[model samples]
Target: MGLEQIKNEFNAIAKTIYFDKAHFLREKASDEKAVRIFLEKVERLLQENDRKLEELYFVYGVFGNLYRVIGHPKKAIHYLQQALCLAERENDDSRKVVFLIRLGEALKYNEEHEKALKTFDKAMDLSDTLQVRKYNDFIFQHKGKCLLELGHLLEAEKCFLEALHIRKEKGDPELVASTELAIELVKKSK
Candidate 1:
């Protein structure tokens, strides 16, 4: 019943309600209204005393992804970079790899192909060092897309093939089909 307790309870409810709504809207084809609401709620949550660093990381990461989905690569890069920094600060290599892949994709979207390739390289190295095979396919797929945009057809095909192999092993038909499409695009480009 106290002021502090009431504030805490309100924050908890707001976090769940706002974030869930934002995510649902985002999933519905990256609605612009969703981005606006998400940004507003995230700003308010960030002003609260109870925000944790992990929560901050998640918020930044999701913000970056939403921006990317909405074709705002510059904004995506900014927030994804912040998320990557937080992951590094926490010494979380797994999260670092994830953010790197996302940041690399944003960079690629912004036509910074060389920088994107470097970012993907860093992600690949870190994922390999951590023995985290789960993200290798993603790393390869994104990197391949960057290379493709840069006109490195052969290298792009190689990366896509690697991704296809991994995705096939994972037995996800959708993933396999996606990589196959990439490979076909490479072939057509040649």
Candidate 2:
């Protein structure tokens, strides 16, 4: 296939990977095999055409998320970092924020609180600049968690409250409740 054709095909594949109904099949459980298939498909596309660095970052981010879901924090961190670097290289603000968020989450789970805080801080800043309010609550929620881990109770509470406010504004009652719980945890720790 021509490089342009490969680009189009890769984009289509990525879209399907992200939005495919097969992914939401509760009955299939779509476990390890499905994840592997998605990974392979993306990898093959990359091998076939090497110019779509942004798409590679996206696929890496997706693979990282899957690794995170599978409870592999280290692998998730590695792939997320790859995605982050590529996103930065591509100057893609949204993708950079996404990889930062994933990297922050993985680092937070690994107890790398300081690094995670820095990563989440960048993600929050980027989200603000990008006007990505959809992800603000998530960014603040993770920032709160990282601060809480670092024993910054007051800071953690602030972050959680901010997250709660965003969730409330966004009509995400579940996240609002979760942020409230975190807020309570921070308060209790004090």
Candidate 3:
């Protein structure tokens, strides 16, 4: 029918499939399979729709996360960088933060702690601009991880404390406890 109708139809199906959500891959095996299938359809849709940059960005993000979980940090970084560039072009602050965080995580897992820290720092700046304290908490947690890896125990502890404060403010006892454990680890490692 019309363009709007086509978009509505795709959006309806997309919500159920969640092909663009990298987090969905962390669910059960069956769910991951479904996500992969949906991803195939999403790829086809992007091709059929002229490979729109917005759609490509989402696809790249999903693939990037998938690669990361599969232990291919290099591939993950490549795809994530693609998504990051698109997010920057669109000026999607929230998505940019997410990409940066995930990119940092991939770098960390790949033993590229210095790069990871830089990415996390960028995320922190964006989180401040966005006023998302939870994101700051996340950034601090990850930054602490990088610092810990770098043998900066004191800095790591400080970062963990900052994360703990934010988590406590958000009333997430579980997160606060986790951060506390991280702090303990820093102390023990020292």
Candidate 4:
């Protein structure tokens, strides 16, 4: 196969491993072994490709998210940082925002609330500068969680309310409900 064809095939396989199998394991089964298997496959693909492919950022992102699902926040943070570096090297601000959010979540999971807040703030700033409203609610919601964990209840409520407003406009019932629950938690904590 030509080099382009090989790259295409690699990207396809990586996407299936990440979006299909890994997501199913995380959401439906929560099977750490299955996730590990998929993770290893992707890692092997990265190695065989010499990590020079265009999809390296995506593969690293998949690794980070899979680590998160298996409750390995530190590992997730490492991979996410790698993904963010690759995204930055590609000059992909949109992908940078996404990686920042994922990194923030990993930090939050590891109880690094202050660092998570900083990461989320960076995501929010990038999204705003890019005029990408799609990720606004997510940034706000995750930032709210970090703030809540840090005992900044009022700030957390503000972030959750902002997220709720955006999610309501987007009409994602699940997202709206999630923000509402966060808001309720903030209120109860007060």
Candidate 5:
């Protein structure tokens, strides 16, 4: 099969998996197990064909998210790092920022606060340089959490406010609530 065909098929399967992503994970007791099984099947197919670096990245992101939800922060970071490396080599700036944000989040949960802060900074820089506002809010949210942990309440509050602005602009009710919660936490802690 041609590379285009392979890419299309891979993307189709990926879209199907991601379509019911939250519902599937929330309903399954062993969500990670189900995700691993699906990934293994896809990986076996990829091994036979060997194509589409971008698809591989999407798969890695899926697994990283699953590992994160399953409480395996180390594995989550590992897969996210792999995705980030591929995204960088491919010059896929959008996915690169997303992976960086995910990696930073995993690192934060792993208690590597300093490294996570640096990672989040890189993501923020990319967002600023690329002018991509959609995922940029994530950098602010994560950075705010890290700063709050570090006792930089004012800085954290600023980050949360920026995130809140983005969420409001995007009309994302859930994120707006989250940003408000972060602001409240920062205020209450001080």
Candidate 6:
């Protein structure tokens, strides 16, 4: 099969793996294992043909996010950093934003609030320059997380409110409620 075909197959598998990990199943350890399996499969493909750095980064990103969700901050940050380098090399703003967000979350969980805020700032700038509205709510949410952690209660509250507004605009009551909960956290912290 050609490279495109391989990429298509990888995309399909990654989507399924991510979806299962996020929604279909609720076991973090199992989800991490499953994500690793997918990463190993992609690594083998990379071993056979190492030209597709972009594809490798994509898998690394998935691995990073899985580990992050599984409470493995160090491993998640490592893979996310790798993915961020590739994203920057490729000048792919979308991937840059995504990798930065994942890395920021991992850093925040690792108690590296300063570093996480810097990462989120870079992502926020890129998202603005790229005009990527899809990521705005999520960026705001994560930024709020960092702010909340750093004791910037007012800023955190604003971020959560902005995120909540976006969620409501999207007509996702569930997401709105979740964002509201974050707002509640900010209020409580204040």
TM-score per prediction, in order, is 0.77, 0.66, 0.67, 0.77, 0.73, 0.71
Worst 10 residues of 5 by lDDT: 19-28
For candidate 4, lDDT tens digit of each residue in 35-94? 666667666766776655356665677667667766788999999998898888888887
Candidates 5 and 6 compared: the better one by TM-score is: 5
Predicted model with the maximum lDDT: 1
| Each candidate's clash count | 0, 0, 0, 0, 0, 0
Candidate ranking under lDDT, highest first, comes to 1, 5, 4, 6, 3, 2
Ranking by TM-score: 1, 4, 5, 6, 3, 2
The segments of candidate 4 whose C-alpha lies over 4 angstroms from its true place after superposition are 1-29, 50-54
lDDT, candidate 5, 69-109, per-residue tens = 55677988988988998988889889889999889878876
Any runs in candidate 3 off by more than 4 Å, and if so which?
Answer: 1-58, 130-133
Cα RMSDs of all predictions? Answer: 7.4, 7.3, 6.7, 5.9, 5.9, 5.1
After superposing candidate 2 on the true structure, give the runs of residues whose Cα lies further than 4 Å from its correct spot: 1-58, 69-71, 129-133
The number of residue pairs in model 4 that clash at the backbone is 0
RMSD of candidate 3 to the truth, in angstroms, is 6.7
Off by over 4 Å in 1: 1-30
lDDT per residue for candidate 1 within 81-168, as digits (tens), equals 8888888888988899999999998887777889999999999999988987699999999898788777799999999999999999
Expressed as tens digits, the lDDT of each residue in 1-190 for candidate 3 is 3335434544543444321123311211224454455446655665666665655766687667655554567977988888888888988888889889889978886779898999999898888888754578888887887787788989988999999888999998878876887777777788
| Residue 131 CA displacement from its true place in model 3, Å | 3.8
Which of the two, 4 or 6, has more lDDT?
4
Residues 43-120, candidate 2: write the lDDT tens digits: 676677764564566567766766655456787798898888877887878777877888998887666878888989
Global Cα lDDT for candidate 5: 0.75
Question: Lowest-lDDT window of 10 residues in candidate 1?
Answer: 18-27
